[model samples]
Target: MNTQSDIKLTDQLERDLIERELGTQRLGFVNDAKRVIAAVQNVFTRLQAEARKAKVVYANG
Candidate 1:
């Protein structure tokens, strides 16, 4: 019952599905990287604030 065109269509569909899944995985990785970058920025910001406070205390004392 299967023709050549039908086989080609099935192959194309399979390729599309694989590409879509890979795209989804890439998006997930990007989101995770963004979250990690944000966390590191927060840590650096807190450290800078603490250093400023320490400097002020040292200068005043």
Candidate 2:
């Protein structure tokens, strides 16, 4: 006994979910952004390690 509005709502949701799963829009950028973020984090970790190895600590006295 669903109304036309209800059917439309359901259809819209299905389409939205399919597009989201396929990453047809901004979701498509998520993987690329994650890769960039990970690369930056890796570089920061390496820099921190090098700084620690060299005992480079800033003391603002």
Candidate 3:
């Protein structure tokens, strides 16, 4: 089993490898993708906040 610190280190290594593979030329595209991901995450957070305010309960079908 991986420890929390070990998992974080592995994730960092993977991100470093991907950045190296993408290189400077594609950095702009990577930045754009990051921005889009951030935007989606923000939307999800807002939705969760709204659901909590409305006392929503999630059910599995």
Candidate 4:
């Protein structure tokens, strides 16, 4: 009879190790998302500036 009914050492150790691995993967994903957001913002800012300049040219001509 296994007396440790829901508290096996192997199970608990495996869960703890897997949880740490997942946490590290999640941190990498967050860093990647931030880098993508910054790149998109830069593109939009440049487009806006060009549009403004074209608008001024049209108004003058």
Candidate 5:
């Protein structure tokens, strides 16, 4: 039979692991964002095509 102390320790250990994994995931996301920001983009020209965005959300009312 597990005691209360054991249960508490297990809970704390799980939380610690989750926090550590989250830190690594966040670092990976930051690295990806930096790469995207460093990408090349064309300068605006006298004759440029209109930019368009896909309708991301549709409202049914």
Candidate 6:
């Protein structure tokens, strides 16, 4: 039995947690773009390594 107030509180709590995790400084769009790009690159590199280990080949033909 969730009320509107409860829903609002839950949303606020989730937002707070995200802000805390990312930090206020990193929350700005300009400040986080570089971090986001680096994170994506890191993930891509890891996935590429996994593909190599699994012998999943890709050709740019």
* Cα lDDT of model 1 by residue, 1-61, tens digit: 5798899999999999999999999999999999999999999999999999999999998
Q: Please report the TM-score between candidate 2 and the true structure.
A: 0.50
The predictions' CA RMSDs to the true structure, in order, are 1.5, 7.0, 17.7, 3.3, 13.9, 13.1
lDDT, model 4, position 55: 98
Candidate 5's C-alpha runs over 4 A off are: 41-61
- Best by TM-score, which number? 1
In Å, residue 57's CA in model 2 sits off its true spot by 12
Say which prediction, candidate 1 or candidate 4, comes out ahead on lDDT.
Answer: 1
Best-first order by TM-score: 1, 4, 5, 3, 2, 6
Q: Write the per-residue lDDT of candidate 3 for residues 1-61, one digit (tens) a residue.
A: 5698899999999999988887975987889999999999999999999888667454432
Off by over 4 Å in 3: 1-23, 56-61
For candidate 2, the lDDT comes to: 0.85
- Report the poorest 10 consecutive residues by lDDT, candidate 4: 1-10
Per-prediction TM-score to the true structure, in the order listed = 0.91, 0.50, 0.51, 0.66, 0.56, 0.42
lDDT at position 49, candidate 4: 100
Regions of model 1 farther than 4 Å from truth: none
- Alpha-carbon local distance difference test for all models: 0.98, 0.85, 0.87, 0.93, 0.69, 0.83
Tens-place lDDT digits, model 5, residues 13-50: 99999999999999999999877665522323312322
lDDT per residue (tens digit) for residues 1-61 in model 2: 5798899999999999998878765666887899999999999999999888677444432
**Superposed model 6: Cα runs more than 4 Å off:** 1-28, 56-61
Q: Which structure is stronger by lDDT: 2 or 3? A: 3
- Give Cα distance to truth, residue 16, candidate 4, Å: 2.7
10 residues in a row with least lDDT, candidate 3: 52-61
lDDT of 4 by residue, 15-48 (tens): 9999999999999999999999999999999999
